[model samples]
Target: MDDGCNQVNPSAALIDLRPVTVLDSITELQTADRHKVAVTGSHGGLASGRHALAHGVAAVIFNDAGVGLNGAGTRSLADLDRWGVPAAVVSHLSARIGDGRDTMRSGVVSACNGTAQALGVRPGHSCLAAVAALRTSAAHAQETDTAGFASASGQVGPHHVVILDSASLIGPDAAGSVAVTGSHGGLPGRRAARALKHPARFAAFNDAGVGKDQAGIARLEVLDSQGVPAVTVRHDSAEIGDGSSTLRSGVVSYANSLAIRSGARAGASLIEVIRRLPE
Candidate 1:
């Protein structure tokens, strides 16, 4: 096989480059009809590959397009827009979507804190991470006002790029109040515990199972602890309450993950899943 561009010998035709950081050379080869990229990980160093894509490559492949990706210099989705490249995410967590996901079908936009993750160019994951990598990049950018999300120039300020879970754990020091959407069991329990500590407003969205699970029970505990209130009903049922009064107004929101589980893939999209969140 021939290795794309550099021709050392006939046997060296099959050029296999793994764990490479610089995508300029590879892109040059593919542009010159010397090489082709079949598949790649959505992990760190994806931005380098994006650099190649920006130059007009054939196609790009990604595996873990979820969270914790490190592009070469691209900081967030807005940054990728400047490069004129779209990233495909293969993960579930919300934060991943907030960072690298482009306008592509499988892409997403997520938020995070500057304490955990890092910023890069490509569309995999950022090295920046929060306690659990839950917050989205937009949320992080809003919280810090860092140019990391600046669409003007790549030169941004110094701030943490980590993804945080929810305001339940910490106070409302980050982006606008984040809404939690997931199975109300595992991490929800922990989030509820955190909410009990501070008097912050919140909302929950659970499916049939989650609405009646241990995590749901824990969330109720948090509400009670914080002196908040809640009411749960089947997907079809509706309740009437005053929307104007803060007391009548809810701090926490809940939904059934299984309510409309057909159209969505394994993990539901933020637009679809959390759409019911109070505006």
Candidate 2:
């Protein structure tokens, strides 16, 4: 059966729709090839994220918004960084922008929804610049095709991070944005960091505070402590989802406000975020 991404067996890749469950079906996906891999499941959170990191798949396509967009999803991005794998997230959320803007986009990486936007860096800029430019980016992607694995959850890579959120999950007042960072190649000179239109610090994190995204920061902090450089996004929505309770518009709005604030606060220490990424 050809699934949306032309999968030979979509069922084989699908994980159970439960909490605290991991996908054993695609465990060997990394060893198979480095092609774009999409992981879909109701409970594809921390456990599944670890598996994806172990496999070191080229890109991760999350089917569910919660799985790869929230706390667990951020951890997955950190894991990918540790493995030196470029990652991309796709979802129905808005992009993260530096100018305190939360815009929305449909298919491609939107300013309000893109990783760079989340970091607050202007488009076509370096990775480090983006993170420094903006305080934080929030939300996860909902659905669509774009560079990397974009989900309503979020996406990260060697030089990029993006977040998207759904109106239902967050709220109407919730803003969307996109963030981008340009590669500085290596050790950026003070002048270079300032002059280069876009200079990105290697995404890394280093902190024990637990930060905002649950276990996600652990990995980034580990790396940031070593000065690997990093960037991150965090968003709070009124209604994350209606796992047991139904999601509502009001709930979503409140949730998004919290998430955006959290992301903004965290954006300041992007390098530290990468250093703290999981090992």
Candidate 3:
């Protein structure tokens, strides 16, 4: 089977590169029949890949953003494969395009999905090359089955803390408890904000790239404005280890370490940080 989509225009040949703030915006371009591709500033997580697949873009590019735990990279690749869309991810540093919306266009490819690879898209290639490759390859039939690509949800944990690897993991059971996640601080689209609306006492996220533009601190502000008491720890810290490590061991270690360093006992609940906030 050809790994390209009928919607792709080989003659158009031009790579329509545009910067998108969040994964959801990619849907807006779906209505166009032109040979278009999207450069998204978001991480190459499963949610991002799902959006790209759903929108039926010829191709998409994202930042690897360290490809943190719980097989985030693997999940993204799987999504593109199932959807038959070509995709690539660039390093976080190369993600600086122009202003906020334009940043996605500036990165170099660090990784690519199987479809993308078959089209000559590979790591070390410019994102433009990836998109160009997509335009020339056979367009894949659009996928209608989306069951396997559904967003992630939450899981219960000890001490009423909800441990999740993605913001999509936020669920009804998490209400009135603290939520700890390996997901990036950035909540890209309304889906993310809506998922988090459940009445949790607080949330914690890995401060992906710390204060980098469009990432860590930017996302933290988004959560704060929504009236969610959220805190962030470094992505590389023991608190937010790769998802393979048990949350009980990694997340708990991070929380306790944070508390002790802040003049509280190890294992203190994140609610303590909330209490210290100004009324």
Judging by lDDT against the true structure, name the best candidate.
Answer: 3
Backbone clashes, candidate 1: 60
lDDT of 1 by residue, 182-257 (tens): 2121222144454333432233322212221233224444454454432221111111111111111122234223
Candidate 1 has its poorest 10 consecutive residues by lDDT at 147-156
Candidate 3 lDDT, 65-133, residue by residue in tens:
555455453357667776667777776556531112433345577788888787677777666555556
- RMSD for each of the candidates: 17.1, 20.4, 7.7
Tell me how candidate 3 scores on lDDT. 0.51
Candidate 2 accuracy as lDDT? 0.26
Query: Would you give me the overall lDDT of model 1?
Result: 0.26
Query: Alpha-carbon error at 241 in model 1, in Å?
Result: 26
Spell out the clash pairs found in candidate 3. Answer: 4-138, 4-139, 4-140, 5-139, 5-140, 69-243, 70-243, 97-103, 153-169, 154-169
lDDT of 3 at 155: 35
Superposed by TM-score, candidate 1 places the C-alpha of residue 176 at a distance from the truth, in angstroms, of 18
What TM-score do all the candidates reach, one by one?
A: 0.23, 0.24, 0.59
Model 2, runs deviating above 4 Å: 1-31, 34-44, 63-70, 93-279
User: Where is model 3 more than 4 Å wrong at Cα?
Assistant: 1-36, 96-100, 148-175, 187-199, 209-214, 221-227, 233-279
Give each model's whole-structure lDDT.
Answer: 0.26, 0.26, 0.51
Q: For candidate 2, write residues 1-279 as lDDT tens digits.
A: 211222112342343211111121223243443333333221122333444555434334221122222343334444443443333332213211110111112211212223323233332332222222221222222232222322232333332332222111222221222221211111111122221122223321111112112322332333234433333333222111211111111111111122233332333433233223333
Shift in Å, residue 246, candidate 1: 15
